[model samples]
Target: MVSLRAIVEDETTLLNALSLTIPEREELASITHPAQRIEWLACRLAVRRLVEAQGVPYAGLQKDEFGKPHLIDSPWHISLSHTTGWAAAVLHRSRPVGIDIEPIRDQFRRVVPRVLSDKEITHAASDLNRLAVYWCAKEALYKLYGKRQLTFRDHLHIEPFADHEDQLVGHVRLPDHEEQLMIRCFRTGPGLLAVAY
Candidate 1:
């Protein structure tokens, strides 16, 4: 089973404890991008804490060329997500896994037409809502594919859904595989839109 949780602090004690738990913690800590550094550390901390309670060791984690995290010698699969002050991860013993979280914003409108197909945009219950769903779903699919050549519009497609204020459903279509994805959108704080995949 996989669990998700939100970390609200940037304390070193928590970060160090997480580094000690995950096998690839040292590697993640080496990341220098300010945003990446914070998220990588926070996510590592959350995943380690969750798996350790189940008797899993942090040293069992590894990452791919795209920097997606996975279990080292163990067979379990893992995925990480972080947005602003929050971080989350999922662990499953079977199947390849991917997860993403984003802070939603109006800026998505500027990029929506580039990624969404005409059919998808038409099906969007509202213009703003459509773009938000499209952005998050594409991000999730990108994380799953774990490759650089894929373009959100040319390579990925998402089906539109009836928009509610807080949740939406869509299907992510890739060149090789198609899967249904669920996106939950809500305000996490002032001026922040959060999407979890």
Candidate 2:
């Protein structure tokens, strides 16, 4: 099983407290933008706590160009996700991984045409759950790509699936990389779908 942990900070104040507990808190706290600072703190704290729990050092954490986190010195692969008042990270000693959590809403449907192929939209149009599966699948791909300048529709493609809310099949169609990605979706709360790859 994949090792995953989630922390929900109901308020900005609580999130700030968690951020200040990280060793790199001072450096991140210096960031001028509030959003950036909070994100930085959340990512650092989550990774650090995970590493420490596993009896590892903070130096093991590393960031890639796309800001994907990896373990430089440890044997674990890691993925991170966050939303309004929640932050989550997963670590595993084997297998590349990706995680994403999104607040479920009809807004996702409006954007579906922009990110999904005509075939995909035709398949998912009737079902809200299926649409969310597609959204989360593409999002997982985006997190894996860890780079900018990717068009969700043109560059990423997810195979059409039946109207099932629990799972979906995704395919990444980038020029040099084409991989079948499996996506598992869960309702973490009233209007949220959390996916992992």
Candidate 3:
């Protein structure tokens, strides 16, 4: 099973509404910017709500050497992403998961050479929405892989899919390992959310 949630809230409101553990508060202290602090806290609150909804107590989170977030004492795997005003998270019962949320922007066109392959660029066809999907899909895949030194244009690949298609297939091609994963994408308000597992 997979559970996902996204929320938009200002820093002051998030600070007032959510309670934090001592460790969580200590972690928050290291983030000096108000915007980043809000994103951090909001993602945690969203994850806590989703876990508690499943009758599991929220035990906070820990990160691995690769910086992948894990439920401290639970069986679920989690991934988090935030952009501007939005924060998003995903929890999976038996497998590693990745989630990313991004707003569509014109910048997607400029990064085509760096972020997409020939076929992916052709599939996008200079369309901002399609480029956004490719970007988010690759980002989700990168987070799922949870390692370093992989490039979107080289290591991660997304199979062609229409703008209206909600599902996608992604490939991770490393010298030592290869993987195929399922990805799902959907519009969320002014942005798109992608989840890979």
Candidate 4:
């Protein structure tokens, strides 16, 4: 099970109202881009919101060797993604998960050959926003897959589907393990948000 939380503030707003722990503040301080810092701030705030709402006291967070974030004192799994105007986080107490948010853009067209398989291209419905949604799905799946060596074109694939649903399925084909993933994307004001688990 995956639980999602999102906030619609831009990075500047989050920085102005920053409420992060010392370590999280240090992490934000290390980010060079103002916008990137904002994304990081938004994600941490969203996670705190989720944790507080769940009746758990927000604790510190830690990173695994891969730099994936997790609670320092809890068993819940976490994944986060942030874009220009939004930040999102996913929590699953029992399993790994991933989440991403991206604006609908024609940019996916330039990377179609690199990110989508032939089947996925056909599945993308020839629309830029649809393509972005599919692209975000593959990305969420990749984060859930957790290894950095993945090539979206060859290793990640989404089954063909109508573009009208809030949910879709993706496949990860590694040399040793092939699995189906459940993914969902939603319109977030000006962007698309996707989650996989």
**Deviation (Å) of 1 in candidate 4:** 8.1
Candidate 4 lDDT over residue span 43-110, tens digit each:
77777777777899878577777777887689988888877666778888788788888888889998
| lDDT, candidate 2, 74-185, per-residue tens | 7677777766555656665666667777677788778886888888888886577777777777887677656676788888777766554567666667677777767776
lDDT winner between 2 and 4, please give it.
4
Clashes of each: 5, 0, 0, 0
Q: lDDT per model, in order?
A: 0.62, 0.65, 0.86, 0.79
Poorest lDDT segment (10 consecutive residues) of candidate 2: 1-10
Give the winner by lDDT: 1 or 4: 4
lDDT of 3 by residue, 81-182 (tens): 887777788988888888998989999999999999999989999999999999999999999989987999999999999668999999999999999999
Q: Give every collision pair in model 4.
A: none
Residue 46, candidate 2: Cα error in Å is 3.2
Q: How close is every model to the real structure, measured as TM-score?
A: 0.74, 0.75, 0.91, 0.87
Off by over 4 Å in 3: 1-23
lDDT of 1 by residue, 1-197 (tens): 43445655555656656544444556756777766666667777766766787796766567677777676667776777777666766665665555566666778777767877777767763466557656765675666556677778777666555555555554555567666655454444322233334
Best by lDDT: 3
Q: Name the weakest run of 10 consecutive residues (lDDT summed) in model 4.
A: 1-10
Candidate 2 stretches greater than 4 Å from native:
1-40, 193-196
Model 4, total clashes: 0
